[model samples]
Target: MINKLYFTSLDEQVQQKAFRAIEEEQRSIGYYTLPDQDITPILSYCDSIPDMIETIAVIGIGGSSLGAKAIYEFVKPLNNLSRKLYFFESTDPINITTLLSKIDLEKTHFLVISKSGNTVETFSIYKYIYSLQNDPSAYTFITDPDSPLEKYANEINASVLHLPDNVGGRFSVLSTVGLVPLALCDIDIQALLNGAQTIKQSFFNDGYLKDTLLKKAVFYAKNHAQFHINCIFAYSETLKYFCEWYVQLWGESLGKHQRNSAFHVGLTPIGLIGPKDQHSFLQLIMEGTRDKSVTFIKIEDFHDNITISDITLPHLETLDILNGLPFSKLINMQCDSVMEALEVQGDIPLDSITIPTVNEHSIGSLIYYYELLTSLVGELIDVNTYDQPGVEAGKIILKKKLRVLKK
Candidate 1:
């Protein structure tokens, strides 16, 4: 079942510091407490969804939509839910145009998510959609309480869900940001929380896993100079988006100027789908710059085992050995081979995560694991893990440019 996550060791002082950081984050940030919050609100909202709604289109970017989009795609094929899920994350004209054409406004329920509620891209899309529909009942707003977006939702009499003010967008996946849309689409939101809670207990209540997780954070923080790049090689087509979500979580949370020092410290995150990327990026990992650490994630059970047909052409008869093997086995072997090659070649700090299956519970646990790791690493690096000053600075500039153009 893969109930817990295990990682390498750490020094005693590093372990204590990481523990202290976890306590502080739990007390202040509250992301660690998200899974424990009452899901009644989310469930109640889902029940309120109109019977005619056939699709859910989430309108937000980065942390706003990435986590929910990732979760939706990861488990979509496993369950045939009544409603379809789509993401409207970009402002590109072509993307907006194509997505709008695919979904019928009458059948689509829009979930507008942004932690700040004033995100320009999010509001731009929300306004465009509003222009087309103008129905308050068709949309739900999820954001921090009392934000401009919330005020707008109230003005329109649309439903509004509030996220914990302390929880950042990337860290709010387990909160209303993710729960609302996923619960509406029939995902086991409770099971997802249960999975995340399991990981939380293992870290806070259990000693071994606490040290194991802290140790990995310590390794990353201590070796930030030597291993500046953290590459996540996830070996499932279903996990491609999960990798993307991780990239945002890891990069945004950890890339910061030190708390008291002038030096900037951060671990660059890279997400790659395996077997598909093995032919391309594998070359760079094996022989390129020696400043990257690799984490490989594999699924133990895909729940389906369709075998290759046993057919052989005269020239391709040599491939008959794999004719009856399950594609799942081939992909796993490819992952194992790559790991073996990396280990044999040596020098890279390598770790692997194996998920028993891609379900709500496991996905929940995986999401929390990375979130906690990012927090711990940020702690060790002496930075504010929850804020994104660099992104905010860019947003300020972008707004001024747009205002000038409008004038």
Candidate 2:
């Protein structure tokens, strides 16, 4: 039922090929049932957690933390709950020490998310927390079955949830990786999964050219040839991590070497909380010399409603033209109008992604949509979307530096 848009540039043959590849790849992953097994337990556990969970901290890096952060921000305004949520994914001692000092570890519930159960940053943080804990039962592990973290959780009588082996971290949000933290934050995980299902059905029923994910793939591929930099600017503060998650998903998946040619992909993310950035980054974005594309995300509503007021200026007391519109709507309209003008003058291509509301379902749909789009782009560029050899290389180098420093 959604009106699908295809790129104007891609040829029919290329489009068809890309679609087939995406379909095969998505099917191989078993998209629909992958998250089902983990979802129920995560939801039930989240529901069962007592009101004693006043403050929550999630410990993990990259995909583990990014997905939950995105969901927390997106759904926080709607729930109006007061529980404070913090995420710790860095190895920097100062950040970790500061984070621990701010929260009472005994009272706070910690969710340790790592699919492999051996991520150095996650393991390091877990070890640090383990050392500080008078009671290890305060922590939970979301990891692969039979993994070290799962065993450790059992040994300590802590809760454990298994992650699907085939599901990559960037795509694991619908599962325990994303669901548990979201549920704890008072977000509706079912609605988010429902949104994902809706998009999945759309991708399945529609033809290649009519597929939204495929269209997104072709659009990026076409533009990527000219403008190598892709930037995602989310207008809402809550959606900031959504852009961060996307940067990782797109960058890691598409940056690789293929049998035909080398694939080069890069993503730069910027978060803007509305008229705030108008004074800061707008001038540079409007005139700066950069080969990049911008995707602007707007949420239709916010927790704080706007009110209309009449204030007559001394010189404009007789003028009655500025008294009609709601401030929120006015701002939204002004932003759209300005963006349209910028597009016309600068030839800067823009994509607008508007959600009817910010909830679990909308978040699910958006995340899943991006995952599919990233996969399609990877396929088009002949890159391996599931592997990240480059990321591990950095870790290897870092370990050698740490050994030398310890001396």
Among these predictions, the greatest lDDT belongs to: 1
Candidate 2, residues 1-407, lDDT tens digits: the string is 13223124446677789878876775567444542344666667877677777778899999888988888877887687546788889989999999988897767888899887778899888888878874766787889898878887888888888776588888777777777777787776777888877777677668332455566667677667665566565656677778778878877877776637664554433455555677877776678765666666666765466666667778876664556556657666756765676676555656667776767777777887777777777777777778898898998998899899999
Give the RMSD in angstroms, all C-alphas superposed, for model 2. 3.1
TM-score, each model? 0.97, 0.88
Error of 2 at 238 (Å): 2.3
Where is model 2 poorest over a 10-residue stretch in terms of lDDT? Answer: 1-10
Cα deviation of 280, candidate 2, in Å:
3.6
Instruction: Give the residue spans of candidate 1 off by over 4 A.
Output: 1-10
- lDDT scores of the candidates, listed in order: 0.88, 0.72
The segments of candidate 2 whose C-alpha lies over 4 angstroms from its true place after superposition are 1-7, 30-38, 207-210, 262-273, 313-324, 405-407
Candidate 1, residues 278-378: lDDT per residue as tens digits? Answer: 98998999999999989889999998899889898889888889988998898999998999899887687888888889799989989988898898999
Number of colliding residue pairs in model 2:
3
